[model samples]
Target: MQKQKTGIRHMFTGTLPQVVASLTGTISAVNDGMHYGWSAPIIPILQSDDTPIRISKTDESWLETMYLIGGIAGLPVTIYLVDKIGRKNSTIVSSCTSLLSWILIALAPNVACLYVARFLSGLAGDMAFVATPMYVAEIADQKIRGLLSSLIYLMMLFGILLIYLIAPFTPFYVPSIVGSLLLITQLASFSFMPKSPYYLLSKNKVDSARKALDRLRTTKNNEAELEDISRAIERQKKEKGRPQDLLLVKSNRKALIVMTVLNAAQHFCGISVMLMNMHSILTEAGSVYLKSTTTAIIFSVCMLTAATFSSFFVDKYGRKFLLITSSSLTGICLLVLAIYFNLKTVGYDVRSVSWIPIACVMAYAAVFKIGLGMVPIVISAELFSNRVKAMGMTIADAMYLIFGLLSIELYKGLSESYGYHVPFYLFSALSLVTTVFTIVIVPETKGKTLEEIQMLLKGEKPVCSNDDDATDNLTQA
Candidate 1:
């Protein structure tokens, strides 16, 4: 019993550095979450009679969407900075941008100021999403990479939950002030963390790469791992990583397809609509038992909880299983929501079933976080080789922003014209389609090293390297 206990302790002790590093790196995500969730509660306040800034309906829509537009504009800069300045530095740049955005929000004099603030927030978020995952994935041991990589989404959810809890009760500028403090904290702490070993190796800083790897692994014998990374980098360096290479190369093309579909499905499932419009959606449900603010809090809590739960099992159960299960169950929940709204729309008495929308949406939040909410980001970080990773992630992020923009716009247009049921039904059907796509097309990447994942994508059998053996021994030790 004592021996078994020691073994278990050893397992966790070995990965402690990785966990700390991942958490520190993902602080930016927490800030991004706050920025994303800020609009949810603040929008109603802006639109009401007692408003800080006067805004039209068009202004209201722009307030929510300007972030995404900024994200789209920021992608070119992100793609350039991610590879040019290094992942760690890129994240530092993002932190500074976030700080500025929040300050702008707190002191906004007009709707135009609000738009610029949201735009900078989106730009900062886009940069963080691209750089943070790459930093975490490159630093983590393969055994725990999924868990570490998933931290990005988990932190983002926490940020959302943080804003939800704070924003509804506080003054308009308070959340912005809080957000600025969080970014400041992130900037100060994350500045000390080492750069990714992979990035170091790519830049031919072999000694610095070794030092970073040793620091991350907390072990001295990393020569085998260093050689492995060097070999992979050399192979990748042979291929010229132009934007077109994402299509012309077989492995790159496969990676692009998987990430594209996954990102599209992620947004098409109506997550953005739900997050940004939770207060309004719950209010429209007409639940007399709980206020919309209270229900929205519950919604964000459930999402954060489900995401926390998923982090424990993502590696154990594998990506495909969780994704398929999450997508299928999410579709069912959305379908139920569609039915409830349709009943209310067609004059059927929904008084007895007023709780259905709350239940379905709460359930959707939980189920969606389990897989659809988090898996795409995890898998996106895993699929591409170092060669085209920056480009692939750029395209993937662009798709995520574009699809999110489309989903939000469609929801607004459809819900206004045809009723909420229309968009819910559409989201439900697309979710089911995403389920089919995952099973038939997406590759299971659990437990594979970055090289092995690339090999699998290229239709070759993955062969274990000396580094895998060495890393496995370190994990076991």
Candidate 2:
């Protein structure tokens, strides 16, 4: 018989605790996705005469833009507490806050309460985005890190897909009720898991960190490699990860530039605007696909399929490869979409191939998940030192929110002034720029350990290139 499969590499399949941590963490992402999909289907309902909170187009715009502002508001709070309180507790609090936001939405009697609730939910979304990845990255075995990192996006896609499927048919309040229940489940499931071993080790709780590592590892106690992990942490202790250091140090600066640029580029590509407002664009496309909710469902399904693929293949394929491919294809699809919209607006009578816009959106969603959506997120996690990871990630997360705001605002303004094709053309150009940047600069971190990643980010000699013996080189570096 072949040698029995047993070690960190099998944490996704063969280890119990690692599986538990990932599942518990991903459950919260459904809440994040619901926050996204909430506005898309409900916007029409709120704008119609049959609503409880009657308002103008301005209020409706606020409902969408407030989420981005809330994301911005949440960064300072997360930065203050993430390292101080531990990733597990911060995550638990994020779940509770998100639940409250939904509950507030359920109980809203006026527009003011709804606005407050949306902002709170935005805060919760950003917190989850910042904390969940850090916790998972720290606790996960290097072999399975790529897969687990992709889970946050996957779960968020499921949440978006969930709302699209159910909310359009149900009463206005039902979606909020169901989202609240999901958050409750995540809170309960997550309370049982341990904090990040890196966090614990940083806090000088060596025994606790070791126990956390043992639980995450498949081999009993992970007895042989535990000491090596402790040693790697010791090496990282020399790198004081203050916020200013992230900007000043050459290696840290390089990683920051790459991380910051990738995060901003993702939003400039116009995915979030498409995500929330795709149905409206579909309706305007004047296709048979717009007759029912099928178009929305298909687009969502395409995204889920792509995110699922990334959840499996990101590690095998590596970050830079996927980023370049995803960015390139996304640019082409956006260009096609721009031309399609322009032709239709000019009375070109292209109903013979009305399917082009829908097909482009679906293809764009699928290819985006494989790389642009997943790689920046995973690579950013690898760039920061543990000492200032909260700050580094908070800055990255903030840029995502700020750029998202610009994307949404720009789409609305440009469409109002010059037609929808303008934003599409602009995003396509940005995607091309992103593709070239990926080829020239983004470093690969497919199988590297966290310490090895930190070393690489610091512009020091890389400790380990592959996950197998990368840790053993930490001391040498």
Candidate 3:
């Protein structure tokens, strides 16, 4: 019996099952990334005679705005679906929505169809975005939680890279069709995946949660770990996280506010538009001589490379160090970009150093990916309890789209009205703010369990398992 118990414990720590679950849960995110990146390459096609649609400049801006607005509009639907149906089912629903959107895009005859297609895709993305981080947090082991959660960003960046790479080589409709089939394949595989143990526990299905955990864990020998999960759920159930919980409770308010600020940081940094506009930005940078498609591929490659390092090293150096350092450097890069563009607009023969803008943007993408890109999402997953996790994510994502909408409009307007540097200055200031907020307010969560994180957010102290200085933080608290 002892040997059998040891065998079970040994099997529990295996990483393969956890990795598979992580990828399965992220199918919607992959599709979302593909859709967002699709816009930049597809825009010029809509203007060309290859398609019947003839979109003006103003219409193009609306096309950009439409996806964000659709995301905001889909929040309530996402919240209701995710909360009512459980994370796994909501994820499946999101994948199907994406599949449909791509089908529409593949067959779109006019601008109106394209508009509706973009909105549907955005709705699907919102659903996936809200569900993925929480699902990852619930299913991943404490040992690899941060890393696995950060993998979501990697998957997203890969999707963008995939589409951008394919677009230049293949016919335009091929990527869309390929994307549709990819969703189909992913959805088919995801159907066999297990549900979140936390979500099962929330429904009082203790035995089922155990089975789900066993399916995911594969290597832990001790019943003690499972028992600890039970105890953690019991503690979290005390605060079921009603919407009023956010307003009435101090701890809840802190979690909500902190998450909102970080999310706003993610948006206001201007990476979203930067990724989408990579092609256009390079073309217009005047001094950067790379072909437009090459620029997009390069940007995606840099981000993907940074994301790999981030996912591997996040737990080693801790989230706080990466966030602070990356954001500060990102700010400096953006400031330089602003100056370069300003000088270029004034005809200062900035071509003497034609590489400045490309170098700045590439550096900015790398630094941002290491910390700001993934840490905010990881933090969001760690902060909320199961009952309120959906609500919390919905609120944070709403803030994301709001600022995203503003940045999209502002980047276009300011670049046209003043200079391209104007928007970078705005982004630089926001990056500075993000860096300071992270340093001042964000708590470290190196190896704490979801429950311990809850206690930390609830003003109780946590002892970190990874860092020797963790006890000092508790005492400081």
Model 2, position 363, has a per-residue lDDT of 96
Q: What are the models' TM-scores?
A: 0.93, 0.91, 0.90
lDDT of 1 at 196: 93
Best by TM-score: 1
Q: Which of candidates 1 and 3 is the stronger one according to TM-score?
A: 1
Clashing pairs in 2: none
Candidate 2 or 1, higher lDDT: 1
- Candidate models: Cα lDDT each: 0.87, 0.82, 0.80
Q: Write down the lDDT that model 3 would get.
A: 0.80
lDDT of 1 by residue, 284-363 (tens): 77864777678778888999999988876676677898999999999999999888889889989888878888888889
Q: What CA RMSD would you report for each candidate?
A: 2.7, 3.3, 5.1
C-alpha lDDT of candidate 2 relative to the true structure:
0.82
Sort all candidates by TM-score, best to worst: 1, 2, 3
Over 4 Å off, model 3: 1-13, 52-59, 220-222, 276-285, 344-347, 416-418, 468-477
Quote the lDDT for 364 in model 3: 84
Identify the leading candidate in terms of lDDT: 1
Clashes of each: 0, 0, 10
